[model samples]
Target: MLYRDGLTREGIVVDVIIVGAGPVGLSLALGLARAGKSVVVLEKDPGLHTTSRAPIIWPRTQEILADLGVMDRFESASIILKQFTMWNADSNHKLISLPISELKDQTHFPQILILPQHKTEALLYEALKAYPSVQVHFAHEVTGLSQDSESVRVRYATNGTSESEMVASYVVGCDGAHSAIRAALGLELDGITYPLMAALADVKLPYNDPNWVFPRLSVKDVPVVAVQIELGEWRLILPFTQDESITMDERVRLSVKNLFHQADYSLIWQSEFKLHQRISPQFALGRVALAGDAAHLNSPVGGQGMNSGIQDGALLCTALVKAIDTRNPALLQPNAEMRHAKINFGVNQFTNILTRVVMLSKGRYMPWVLRILNLVLKIPSLRQKFLMKLTMLGD
Candidate 1:
C-alpha cells in the first residue's frame, strides 16, 4: 500500500529502510518482510515505472522469485522462451541455437521469462501487501543519510516539500546508476564507460516469428539483438557509434528498417543509453549498503543486469534478516563480499566479454572469431557450459 505522512513513525524503529522501490528494492523489501523484519521502502517516484526497461528474467532470478512465492504470478503474466538463436544477417545463416528446454530436468523454470520491469515491480508490490511488516512510501525522496553507533538515520522529503526523518537498523540502496544513497556514502563505482551508445525499442512487428526468441543478427556492420517479448511485440537493441546529429527516433527507425527490412512496425517506446561496465568499490559501508544498479552496472548483451540486481537483493535481504535476527551486524559482511565477487568475476566479466564480442563483430577479426565460436559451440559439453554461463547459473 502507498504510505502517507503519518506513516513515517519518527521515533519508532524499523529494521530496514530500502531507498528505492524498483524491482530490486521491492524484491528486497518483500524478502525482508517475509522473513518478519520491519521494512520501509522509500521511492522518489509517485508510481511504478511505466516503460519497459529490463525485459528478460533468467533462470536463476526465476528461482529466487519462486523461493519468494511470486513465481506463479510472474509465470502467469510472462512468456516462456525456450530457445535463443544467433544468425548472420548477410547470408541469413543460423550460427548456433541454444535449446533452453533441454534443461527441464535441472530447473523448474529452465527458460527465460520475457516480462517488463514494471510488471515485475507490480507483482513484487502485490506480494508485499501480504506482509504487515512492510510499508512502501512513494514520492518520498531520500535527501540526507547519517548513521551513528546504533542505527542509520534517513532524511527524506515528500514531493520535495515537507521533510522528515526516520531511523532504521540498516539502509539499503537499490536505486539506479545515480543512486543518492551511494553518493551520500561517498562510494565510488569503478569501471569504464563504453564509447558506443545502444538504442532500444519495444515495437509491434507486422509479422509474428515464433522463432525470433533472443535472436542476434549482424546486419551491415551493426549488431542487432531482438527478442520476442509477448505476442507480436518485440524488443530490439542495437549498438552503434555515438552520433549526436541523429535523433533517437530516427536512429531506431533506421535500425529497425535495416534489420527487419520493414518500416511498418508500430513503435511502443524507445530509448538510447550509454553502456557501462562498473562495480561499486564496496557493496556495503557500515550500516548502509547497495544493491541492483546502485552497486553494479553491466552490458545488456546477455540480459544480465536486471537478473544480477535481483540476485543482489535476494542475497542482501538474507544477510540483513540474519543480521537483524542475531543482533550481529557482522553477519552482513559475508554477503557483501560474496555479491561483490560475483559481480566482478561472474556478471561483469561475462557481460564485458559478450559486449566486446558484439562490438568487435564490426571489426576485421569477427569472421575468424565467429568461426571459432561456431566450432566451440559444436561440442555438447561446451554448449551446456555456455548456456549455464549465459543463464547466470554457472556461478
Candidate 2:
C-alpha cells in the first residue's frame, strides 16, 4: 500500500503518530482511530509472544475494556478472580476472603479478570487490524524527531536499514520505561528504587480450588502472596523463601525448585523486578504527550499497574479527540495535567499502603501484632471498608 505514485511530502499530514505497540500504545491507537484519526504505530518488536509481565487485570480495567467494544474478546480468554487467602508461614492461622458483592450492580464488568498482559495486547491488536486508516509497522524504531511551529517530523528506521518519514500533527509517547520521546523532551523523573528485588514466577498449583484465592503469608522465613488463576496456573510473589535468603540471582530458580515446590509446570519466564515508584514531572511537553508507563510506574501491588495505565490512556485519548476536533491544543493540555495530578496522588497512596502491608512482619512483637491486625479485620464495618480499597472499589 505504498503511495509511490510520485507523491512527495507536501502538506502537514496525519492526525497522530504513536510510538510503541504495547498495551498502552495499542489501546490508544484503537481509541484514536475509532475517532476517525489516522494513526501510525511503530513497534520495535517484529512479533509477539515474548513476556508475561502483568498477570492480573483489576475490575476497573474491565470497565475501560468494555467501553472499547472488545471486552467479550478478553473475557473469553481469562478467568474471574474473587477470593483471597492469607496464611501465617509458621503457624496454621489463615485468612480467606472474597471481594464485596455490592459492586456487581455498579458496573458492566463487576469482577476482576485474570489474564496475561501479552494476551491483552493481542486482543487489542486484533481489533485494530480492522481499521483501514490505522497501520502497525513492526521492527520500526523512531530514530530522531524535530518539531516546528506547525508540525512534528518523525524519522524512523526499519530493521536498522531502510529509512522512512512521517509528519504528525501530534505525537504520543507510550514507548515504555526508556522512551525515546520522553528522553528527547529532556523530562526529569525523580523517585526511589527499593532494595528488595521482587521475584515473579507463573506455575500451576498442586491443589485445586473452584474459587479465586489470594494467599498472604507471614511465615518465619519470608512474606509471600499467592494469586490463583485459570487452567491450574498461579502467580507467586514472595520475599526470599529461606530464613537466610539467597542472593537475587538464585532466588527465582531456587524458589521454584525447592521453596515453592512448583517444578511440575514449565518454568516459562522469570524476572527480578524492581518495585519503582516514579512519575514524570510533567506529562505533556507541547504537542508531545506521555501516557502509561511512560508517564508513571508503581509497584504491582493490588493489580494497579495496568489498570491505572489504561485509565490514563482512556482519558488521554478522549481529550486528544476533543482537541483535534476543536483544532486547539489547550483541550489536550488539561488532559495531561489533570490525569498526571490524579495518577501522582494515586501512586503515592498505593505505594505507601502496599509498603505497610508487606512490611507487616517487621515489628518485633510478631504474635501480639498479628492478634491486633486480626482484630481490625474481624470488625464487620472496618473489614468492609478496607476490602473495598484493597479491591480497588474505593476512590
Candidate 3:
C-alpha cells in the first residue's frame, strides 16, 4: 500500500501516527517529533480556517504552549481576560466579580488568553512544520485499523480517491468526541448528556466591556444556561428544540431568537452543541491510544474542552517519551488505563461545577440564595477555594 510520501514496495514504518489535526493532534505531533520520534499527522479537513470557536486559553494551557515556544505567537493574536463578572439579571446587581490577578506568580502565563482555535492550530502547525521528521497530510481520513504485537497498520483514503496503508509503532487518537479510532479500537465511551443542548455562535457586535463575558444565569434554577462569549458572541443552553432531533442551525437560531426576541445579531458561525460528560473506558489499547476529545468529552462551561485537549497532548507526549526512553520498549503500548482515569476525573469535576452552579438558581429562595453565595464569595478564603475548583488549580 502507498505510504505518506509515496508507494514503498518496502513497507515503511514510523514511530508514531496521530489522527486529527486540531490543536491537540498538532501539539502531540510537536511533542513526539521534538523528542526525536518520527511522527505523521492525518487530517480529514482540507485546511484550517480562523475558527472563532474555543478562543479561551487558560493559564495552564498557556504555560504548555509557552514551553513549546509558541506562546508569543498566540499572544499576538489573542486577548487576555482579566475578570469574570456575574450579575443578578433581575436586580441588575453585580454579585461577584473575580479577577485572575490572584493567580499572579502562580503560573508563568498567569492570565487567560483568548485566541481562536483555528489561530491556535495555525501556530502549532507552524511550529511543527519546521521539523523535517514530522509530516501532516490533509484530506486524509482513517478508514480502517489493524494492530499487531509489533506495530499498527492504518488504512486511510485521500479525497475518497485512493487507499493507502501506513505502519507505525504507536497511534494516538486526538479526534473529537465521536472518534473513529476510538470506535475502531472497540472502546466504550460511557457518559450522560445534560437535558439542555447548548447553542454557540460567533458574531461581530458593538460592546462596552472589553474583557467581560456576561452569561445569563438561570431565572428560576432549572440547570439551564445562557452565556455571552467574548465581546460579541453568545451561547444559550435550553431543552433540545425537538427534544430528540435538535439540528445545529435550528438550535442556534432558536437560542438567539428566544433571547434577543429578534435575530438581529449578525451570525458568523453557529452550531448546536450538547454538553456531555463522557470518557473512553481506556486511553490505550495496545499500539493504538486515545487523547483529547477521544479520551474524554465534557461541557464547555469553563472552557475546559480545549484546555483538557491541550493537557492531553502534553501529558500523552510526556508518557510516550518516558516509554521510549525506558530500557524495555515492549513495556510501552499506549498506557490507556491511567490516562483514561485522569481524563474521566477531569470531566467529572467540570460537570459537577456546572451542575452545582445551575442548581443554585432553583426555587423561590434564589434571592436569598444569591445573597448567601455572594456573601460567601466575599470571603477571601472562600473565594480562593472557589477559584481552585473553577480553575482546577487545586488538582
Q: Can you write out model 3's per-residue Cα lDDT over 1-395, one digit (the tens) per residue? A: 12445423235466788999988999989888788877889888887756667777887788888878788888877766576555555455665567677877566665667667887888899999788888898899998799876678898999988998888767888878879999998986788877655555665444424433555443332222345545565544443333555455555555444334355566677666667888787788776778888888887767778888887778778877776566233444445555666666664675557655644544234445656777888888888766665655555
- For model 2, the local distance difference test gives 0.70
TM-score between model 2 and native: 0.86
> Which has the higher TM-score value, candidate number 2 or candidate number 3?
2
Clashing pairs in model 1, backbone N/Cα/C closer than 3 A: none
Minimum summed lDDT over a 10-residue window in model 3 is located at: 216-225
- Candidate 3 yields a Cα-based lDDT of 0.70
Order of the predicted models by TM-score, top scorer first: 1, 2, 3
Best by lDDT: 1
Tell me the TM-score of each prediction against the true structure: 0.91, 0.86, 0.83
RMSD to true structure for each model, in Å: 3.3, 3.8, 4.4
Candidate 2 local lDDT, 179-209, one digit each (tens)? 8888888885667665555677666656544
lDDT (10s digit) by residue, model 1, range 1-395: 32333444344468899999999999999898888788899999998888888989999899999999999999989987787666655466776667887777768878888898888999999999998879998999999899875789999999999998988888999988999999998987899998778888888989765655555455554446567677888787767747567666766676566656677888999888889999898898788889999999998878988899999899898889888877777777778999999889999998999888877766334445666887887898988888888888888
Residue 387, candidate 1: Cα error in Å is 1.2
TM-score for candidate 3, please give it: 0.83
